[model samples]
Target: MSSKIQVLVQPGTIIIIQNNNYKVRLNMIYGKVRVLRNSHRAFKCIPWLLILFASTSTYAAFTDSLTVGNAKALGLGHAVTADPPGIDSIHFNPAGLTRLKGRQMHIKGVYGLFETNYDLGGYGEYQQGLIDELLEYQYPGSNGVIPPEAEAYFYDEALNSKSSVEGPTVMLPGGMIDIPFAGGVMGGASYSPPGSNMTFATNVYAPMMSGYNRAEDDPGRFFQERGAFTLLTYFSPSVGIEISDELQVGFALNFSYAGMGLELPAREPHLLLWQYGHPWFQDNFCNDDGTPTGTPDLNLCHIVSPYISYGDLRIEADQALVMSYNFGLLWSPEPWITFGLSYNSAVKNDLDGDWEFPIDPFFNQVLLDNMNGSLWPSFQALTGALGLPLPGVAETEAQGKGGKVNVQYELPQHASAGISIQITPKWKYNFDVKWTEWSVFSDIQINFDRDIAFLMLGSIADKLLYRGQNGIEPNGVRYQLNLQDVTYWGMGTEYQYNDKLAFRLGYENRPSAVPSETPNAFIPINDGILYSVGIAYEFESENTLDFSIGYMNSKSHYPPCSADLGNGCNPNNVAYGPYQGQDLRSEVSFLLFEVLYSRYF
Candidate 1:
């Protein structure tokens, strides 16, 4: 037996061990696993790949995920790892803080628009076709119409969209905050005692903020009706030291608050559900399985459809402290060019929260009244012997807990390297390449302290319908994202128009980190282009003001039944809930503006 554990590092790439001493590659698509004689070669290739990432494309910023909160960094498309911005250097590059002298303060403000639109399609087409075909085979006259239950499940209700008009959610040390008009407020300061080689600074800001509210009538509500995720580095203390004139290094520790809230209606739109919805299924299997003792006409699968929601789930999770750190190095080998590198440690947020999963009243009643037979002996007990309240008897009042719920979430590691080049006295440009370990999201698991109505449903239809292949275990559930590690390039330029004013231009090509196979509107932004411009004004008293504006746009297209594993585009497994058939296309755009005031005292 091979001692090596199979770890999935990248998509389509896996390392396998055999013969106790050999490593090989596993080809999952083939019947047998493929092996290489020189498995050590795979280990040797890792370093080379990182070196090659200098020119590839990676993940998105802003509303997509990691948002560069510094106005200067935003203006430069976040290529400022080599030329970090003022006090915000505590995040971009700690070493850059060493460049600050005397006492300084920077107050910043930001406003942005996050917009998303989706083209919903063939909601119940796939499942309906199956129903019709089955009906035709069983009874030709039944082929004329779509069932009422099917419409309820796949209703093309009012579509929802996100706009800048809504408020923004912010997580702070004390509590969650809400701001008006898609904007944020923050400030930071730094100090370097006279003739000292070290500089110290502190800043509070949100590195990543995501959330939105939509109408309840939206059919897409099944996937994401409303949700918010905020990571606020409320307390960050950092220091930088000048080891020498040519070399500088710095490190910082951050204490943050993370909060996530989501309200999603749940449903099963899998193709298998359509099979059970057939009349033949109910006629043959809906009654009592043992002989002659006939029972009521218990309808089991009639109410089950790809379009009908079974329940609604709302989660509120927060972590008091999310600990993380950053390290950076700056080396100036030449007068015109400087090389910088920085690393951000990964963080795991074990959040504490509560959850409620309430089954729909009508759907609840359907099950309470009609479910019967040996196929569901356990359910029979709940409706009869065990004495569950009558269907729709205000099930909303139910709350039984074994313990508090917790969600384990990860913030992946980040490594960035860049160079600042002074082409001439007035023209300077910066280029950076970054790698983010987004693959940590290959699977995101949720653990529950108590059993809920939604989790309870998985036991009955584990494989053929919904609740994943094995159904969600009563104690835990997992969602597989299968994300990939991303490597991307960013660049920016600053032209000193004169001593008092400078013009900046930046461009970054951010590729989607989420696998194409699982792409959907819930996450929204996809492969995109970021374009930005900014200006800096210097006063006679050495005070400076900077302002910038940037925009990012992305879109994706998924055809019917094209995704592997019957998820996302396939609409066959309800992997993304309501994102079934209609040539799904998603467009997301971000328009943002920022202002920063830096004063030297």
Candidate 2:
């Protein structure tokens, strides 16, 4: 018999080939793997040769820790902790409602706007053909030496172009309505309740809305192929009591709901490298001394394929939903001087929903070609003689069901303090500071109803050992994430030109919670500063109309590898496998707008 071993393959079936040269096994549906036996008959196998691999919302951490929800809040840089009082105060500090007289109602509309872009340098190119050509020439042939023309072509035409990804403007809308009832005797009767100044209020609003979608060809696809979005809304009923003219306390019952959608690349970069960069494959192409020859082995280039290209594939979760509380205090020692504080409790959001995984065309074609190639004729003839089932190549659909997916994330709790001072008769100055326990946002857990053992050979072997048998061990895929804490501060001033008009200006700063060593392309955030302006017009009816606008242009953070930061940047610190050396250069900006209407009844 020829030195080469013959083999037959079947869809969704396994075949064992035992020969003097090597023992090869096939697993049709999950992924591809080949096994070889040594002299001692001990099989050397790389686990999970091939399996389903994809990414989903691994980095949707605590970006929502702080938000400017209303016009007065935005205009004042959300520093309302101690200064002016409005319906939006219910969010900043419910106790502030004690300052309102008579029955009152407040309505406000808010929008979070974003426009962003990123470039990882390797956009719009695939390294597969280049890798294949390099590997083929490593076979001690003249072609093994890449010609100067070929080397030039690889850098000039293949790598020199810009493939930046830009997203259109995205707008997230939310609104709040509040009704506060000031408690006192309805008529001018002599009877006075001890706690007559108590006020009860209820408000409903969307607290946070975040989403982004990237092109499939984007190089960062290995980390976040597409993107994700989340929207959270809450209904709060509260009571505020003015114990005396100088002090007030507030309590609110918080009921919240969250919905999320996410999509990611199919195969994680590391997994692809694990499957293709086996030591055996490396030894075959490199020189006997393990040093690169003058021609250099091209198979080494296979390592880069998983890093630079996304293969235009995706897996997505359609929806997931969860529920969480907030407490407030406001103290006014004098008419011009005030202090405020608030604490929001942490909440865990568990999102469960449908998911989708699209099959990769390149992987499918490769599997088909291997099964139907030149060796199939002899392999089929032998299997037929041995009365084995005829081998057939199974065609995978472009996509498959991703069963129910459940992912859990923690929304961090935040505490804030503020002070407001009337510097002059017409100018009111405010200062606020906030801190979030983002440490609690450490990790995200992703679990699926179905066992993803189909991707790992170890799980497959265990499944086979107990298939149709009782007492089988269970195995599934799980992923996690870790994050850090953040701080924010704001300063604002409101000028009352007259009873009919008021002007507002403020500034705030928030720093990134993501560590540089653990950078994620999805969250792509940094130190941010927001400059805001607003105006309030009082109608003859004594009702007020307010509008505010906020603009934020964040500083760019180029990984040390990209910026020549004194601290040397190692691609492996940020990414794994082939994607390790890729540097990320990102710029992010935001625009916030709000409108509020208040009426005293």
Per-candidate TM equals: 0.78, 0.66
lDDT of 2: 0.48
lDDT of 1 by residue, 1-601 (tens): 1132222222321222222333334321100000000000001111111010011011112232235357788778789888888888888889999999977767677777766665655434554465468657656686546466445543534222222213344333333334445665566667788888999887666666656554566654554555566666655788999999989999989887676666666554455555556656656655545222244444453535545666666667788778999999999988888999998888788888776656667656655554333435555456445333222212223522224678775767889999999999999999999888877744445687754433444423332243244325445655445567888888999999999999999898788676665543344566788999989999999999999898888776655544322113232233333444444555777788888889875
At residue 128, candidate 1 shows an lDDT of 44
lDDT to native, each model: 0.59, 0.48
Off by over 4 Å in 1: 1-66, 123-128, 134-179, 281-305, 369-403, 453-472, 517-521, 563-576
Candidate 2's TM-score reads 0.66
Model 2, 1-601: lDDT tens digits are 2232223323222333333444435221110000000000000122112123323332333344233256777788778877535544455676776766555555555554555545554421223333445545543354445455444322322122222323321111111111121000000001112447876554544444344444555544444434433333334556677888888877666554454444444332333343364445555655666443443422242322332232332233322234446678878778889888987777777756555555455554444444555665576477547433233353123224456666566777878999999989999999999887766655544455653323223233323443412111122332233346767799899999998999999898876665565444435446678889999999998888888988876545444233211111232221222232334455666676667777754
Error of 1 at 546 (Å): 0.8
